[model samples]
Target chain A: MKKIYLALAVFSAVAIVIGSTVLSVSYEPLDEVAERMNLTGENLLGSPFPEYTIPGFPCWAGGIISGLVGGIIVFAIIRLLMKVGEDGGN
Target chain B: MHIPDGYLSNKVWLTCYAISLPIIAFAYIRLKRKMGKMEVPLFSALTATVFALQMVNYPLGPGGTTGHLIGTPMLAIIFGPDAGIVGLSVILFIQALLFGDGGITTYGANTLNMAITASLVSFYSYLLFRRAFKGEKGRVISGGLAGWLGIVSAALLCGLELGLSRATFGYGLNITIPVMGISHAVLGLVEGVITGFAVYAFGKYKPELFSR
Candidate 1:
């Protein structure tokens, strides 16, 4: 049962990826799609890219850094609070 | 809100990453220390719940607006803030890498907003309310109330972050915060109800875990 469930989840995920890819392909001239959706923003490289305007940045590098950095800081703050709470308990 | 790629400035994103690394390391250490007998079942349940909750994106308002429950607070109350944070971060990371629900660049920011805030706020709220209400009733009420408050706080924090992004990028913060906050406030309410009920149910069935 668990295996079947896992398989279904995997298949669903793959289907979503494929579906998104196909949607992006069909909507190739994203400008038209953007106009259709009444989206206003800079052109970007994904299905909903135009809907969400591409803000100015070193896009790829910024994304990696954001993921890495934001994850770290939140983790640190959580630890610090835990320490404080423990000290208070003591 | 799942922050898509190309929404934020690169420099700001990197800066967030730089700030997060050491913090994540410290959190990992704490998580290792706190893993006890019930931790596995608790963590497993939380991971499944968070993933399931995030799958249901309710309409916020108007066109192109929707919000999902980022279930960190409920996890924190059950597992303590440190473990909850670590666990949720892992879930977020996996979601980014595999599912692509959120931007790769914004995972750090998202993790901080969802897990950190939810866990801390919910944990403290539960602690405070746990004291006020006595016995079985207290545990259920406190659990539900804490979950609601924690989720709302996370939403507000996310709104604040969005406002900051807009300001830093030369967009109007005034326009962003209201849209973001109001939408998330509704999302938070939904999260609060479900989470509160879940906690209440868990306590009712397994009184030993919640009981003092």
Candidate 2:
């Protein structure tokens, strides 16, 4: 049973790695329209890493890397009001 | 669906942001109060899975459009709604800030749709269906149906938000709602199947995850 679970985990990991190649996207016709509709793009702290900037890197690469940093950062957060922190003590 | 920047008008975005404040507070309290050492691994694994799944987009019919598994339903069903909400919020935040999958300005609206709506809808619906059905077979079926409904609702809401921005977006409910709804209504079936399968696999392999 454990081996099966491990295999499934490994399969999933492989799938994700392969899946990374398909991440770049646009909203299609909706996207074309989004460009034309033209609402103010002003943001206080605009996207530090817009998808447009990264031409070749798969979107998940950003997610996986950011997640490492973000996950560690969130431990501090979870402590006050999330699953890892307040109610669930180490 | 990740609504990018400049899509939602200020009115629409700000309203969602305002509406989310109290919901976040409520979820925050519940999130802090639940889970223990035993629940941590499964919780973390599911969170990672959700993040992973969101990045992969599958084609939506022949329209040249695609969508990903909005994987919160399984999390909500497994760990509870609060965890789903907070967990998804964290993922969406990271996606927006770094990957540009979504917009920081539209973050509130995206969170409202994916995190709060999906979490609450799936959690309660799963409970309702599970109670009605009974047994292991019932659990799997319920998980699938609940997950399907959850994503459909989120998609419809997305359509509505985008449609509402029609004044600014040049696409009203007539255009946006049906397109979003139809695509997701189809996509929701896949969500259901995956949710049901996950429920069955976990129940068979690690029943302990459901105990708390």
Candidate 3:
């Protein structure tokens, strides 16, 4: 069961990467619409923010890496929060 | 959909913030009151997993625009609706603040659409479907359908919000609604499949997670 879960996770990851790559390079109508609608803008920090993309990697690869990193960060934060809550409760 | 900062006017975004803030506070309070300490790690882990999954964007037909999994249905199924709201809000907040995937100004709108609307819709939809069917098969089907409908519902709400912003931002309902609706409808299928498989796998492997 664990192996199956692992396999599914890997397969899903691979599929995501490949799909993202194709989508990144392909012509996106929504993006065009957004552009037409003038939805793109700067980040909250006052810096220019563009759509999801990486200079050296494909969009999918970048998404995968960033997502994993984000997950780790969130997991750590949640665990820390839990610890703090536990301490407070005690 | 991660609406950028300039996309929504102050009136629109502020209204969204006003609406979403109270709901978020309510969700937090409910989570604190209802959930045990042991559930914290599982909730956090699942939230993080959903955050990661949202990053995986698949193409919608020949258009270059991509759509990602909403994961609200799966989260709601596992942790219930309130937790789903909290989890998705956290993910969206982080993405906007740290990754700049979404705009901070428009964060409220995004939260309302994805976290509140999608979560509740998926949760209730799943419950309805689950009652209609029986056993493990029922749960899987319900989850998939919920996921699909949840995303579409969220997209529809987003379109409405965008359309409302027309007076301030100048983009009308016709433009935003159809575009968001069509793309998300297609993407919802992928969400459905993923949700179904996930429910099935989790049901088979870890029945404890489903225990309330």
Candidate 4:
């Protein structure tokens, strides 16, 4: 089960990388359509990571990185909550 | 479908908030009463997983906007409807406030369509399908169908809301409904497959999770 979880994690990471690449590459045309449709909203679909404006990091990359980091943080919080629950029970 | 702030009219968004708030409150109370302590981690984990999965936006069609997995059905199936509501609400809230994926003003509308409607419809449909069918295959089929149906139902509701907003704005049902309906109908298959596979795998590895 542990091995399976590890494998799934690895697979998800790789998939995220590949998926991000594909989405970034293919995003332009769809973005154009969204702009035309006026779906971009207030900031024109602003980068998820607003603070990190490094030269090398693009918007899509920021989105992908922020998503992954957010997922990890959420998972960590879940673990902490679980621990608290367990402690309370004991 | 992550409807931004400006998409919905004030009346429409306010109406959605009015409808959703009570449901959310009810669900939260029910979850607090019904859920076991041990279930907390699993529930939170699953919710976070759904939140993470929503980030992966698959391109819908040529020059069309992308659609990500809404996992409401899967969450409802694994947890109960109440938990599903809570989970989706949290995810949507975080995404809106932090990421700005959906608009702060339109959060209620998005929650109504994606969380409440999708979860309830999927839960009932899954129960119906599971009862009609038989064993392991039945479970998989039911989950897949529920996932697909849930998405389409949410999409339809979203379309209706968008259409109604046209009275204040200009985008009518003729445009909004057809576009949302068609795109969601196609994208829903992916939801089905993902839900089916996840349910099947869990059924195999952790059958106890669903025994209740």
Candidate 5:
């Protein structure tokens, strides 16, 4: 019980630090490392690399929401999956 | 690292899917067998924790680029690799489907690098080092090295994938492998420290989480 609270407190603190752009500096996505180089995409089959960052929510908001919402979703789904497994994949 | 779409050639991506699918299935099977004691609260907490942590991109010194935690190492160190793999797979799935952080096409590759490989390496390395060392301080040090090794191994695998994706990424093995490997080697230090602290914290609070 104490561990849970500690974990949540730590998680929320991390979420706030990373989610708030003011607190954390943003870095370029790793995939784009190629873009910064002299190499051109024309050599590859897909000429233009795609951008796949999160949409809509800011980092902090998304972090908090996912932590809260994802916890419930993951628990329910994992439980359901276990039940199905016990039922022989019915 | 999350390899986006169009970064991997069909051959590379497909091969990754083929290789990763079986391993993930095995992890799932293992997870199910132990589901009763699976510790969903901790797993979910860590999953969301890592999900948010992955978003925090730290600058990689003067390289004009950045890196973030792969995190499976810490999870593996605490809860064993099987749970670590399962949890990371879930995080990557959400990141791809909802956040667009990774690609559906590249998921296999991403999972292969960040989850499966990272957890395995982290877990085994910890075991190996723990056996070689003793006491509380040694355990924390072992955890740190295991974390470093895990992320570095993932980076190396990512480099290999990108290197193989010369037909798709326009970078040959020489370019992609070294960049990914070297940069990650540096970034892995941070992983090592975090993993060590995680080991310390867990040992102090939830010692039961550590597997025998």
Candidate 6:
């Protein structure tokens, strides 16, 4: 039963993204057809449908490297804080 | 969100795992220390509740952002940080495996972001606020503040991670980071309220939970 809820949530989220994308695509061409109803390009990209393309290898590479490095830094900081707290007995 | 397959480079997932291992081990040790055989049901039930709640997502404009209210920090305030981490990780794991909310590979990163960070931040902030207020209200306020801060903090850190990935991959950090960050901030505010209320209510009803 709970699993069903989870599935529904994930499905709806995906649907929302897809619906937004469809709206954006539909609107993108409409501007050319009807400039007066000009729903701005920025709005199409920013809200509802985020502008996402298949990122090239560069984006993937950067994200991986950054995620690992940042994770380490955060881990170290958290460790230090924990050690201090343990020593302080709090 | 679950990191979809191929959404992130292998290095990112590896790094997240590398960092998460020790923290997870520590959490396990902490849980063992506090565990009572009878409490398993209570914990599992709580985990289910968190998972179910987090699954519900309200729409965000054209894009839909839906999920539980994200109350990890509040859990930590009442159940100690390490135990809090355990509870959160369990929910994330269940979501990934059962519901497919997050990607399998991205589990490490997602756990680190949602559970590890929020739990610790809430624990520490609560301590600080408890000292500042020097009373019961202090505890309540701390719970809410920590809950709010924990969610926002996770959102910001997630943005930073995304931005860095964009930079490393040459995806144009200028575009991805701001977009992710702004969306999360708006979402986080709503999440924060939910988290804050959860913590405040728990503290009121079960003050004994926060006493420790």
How does model 4 score on DockQ?
Answer: 0.29
Residue B73 alpha-carbon offset, candidate 6, angstroms = 1.6
Best DockQ goes to which candidate? 3
Encode model 2's per-residue lDDT on B1-113: one tens digit a residue: 78877788889999999997688778867665556655655566567666656655666633666667888898888878988888788778777876576788789999999
TM-score, candidate number 1: 0.65
Q: What interface RMSD do all candidates show, one decimal each? A: 10.5, 4.2, 4.1, 4.5, 5.9, 14.5
Error of 5 at A84 (Å): 4.1
lDDT of 3 by residue, B1-212 (tens): 87767777789899999999899879877877787776776678677777767765676543656677878878777778888888888888777866676689888999999999998998888888988977999978988999898888988888888788886456688877887788888878998888888777777776776776
lDDT by residue for model 2 (A57-84), tens: 5566754454344444433344333433
Give DockQ per model, in order: 0.05, 0.32, 0.38, 0.29, 0.27, 0.03
> Distance from true position, residue B67, model 5, in Å?
1.2
lDDT (C-alpha, whole model) for all candidates: 0.56, 0.72, 0.74, 0.73, 0.74, 0.54
By DockQ: ranked, best first: 3, 2, 4, 5, 1, 6
Worst 10 residues of 2 chain B by lDDT: B53-62
DockQ-better candidate, 4 vs 5: 4
- Report the C-alpha displacement of residue B27, candidate 5, in angstroms: 0.5
Residue A64 of model 5: what lDDT? 54
Per-residue lDDT of candidate 3, residues A1-90 (tens digit) = 346435545654654465455443433344566676565556665422233344587656666666566676777776664455556665
- The TM-scores, chain A only, for the candidates as listed are 0.36, 0.37, 0.50, 0.55, 0.39, 0.32
A1-90: candidate 4 lDDT, tens digit per residue: 455355446545654565456643334222342455666455234545542122367865765676677666666654553354345554
Ranking by lDDT: 3, 5, 4, 2, 1, 6
TM-score of chain B of each: 0.85, 0.94, 0.93, 0.95, 0.96, 0.84
Q: lDDT by residue for model 5 over B76-106, one digit each (tens)?
A: 8887788778888887876676555677888
> Residue B178: error of model 4 in Å?
2.3
Measured on C-alpha atoms, candidate 6 has an lDDT of 0.54
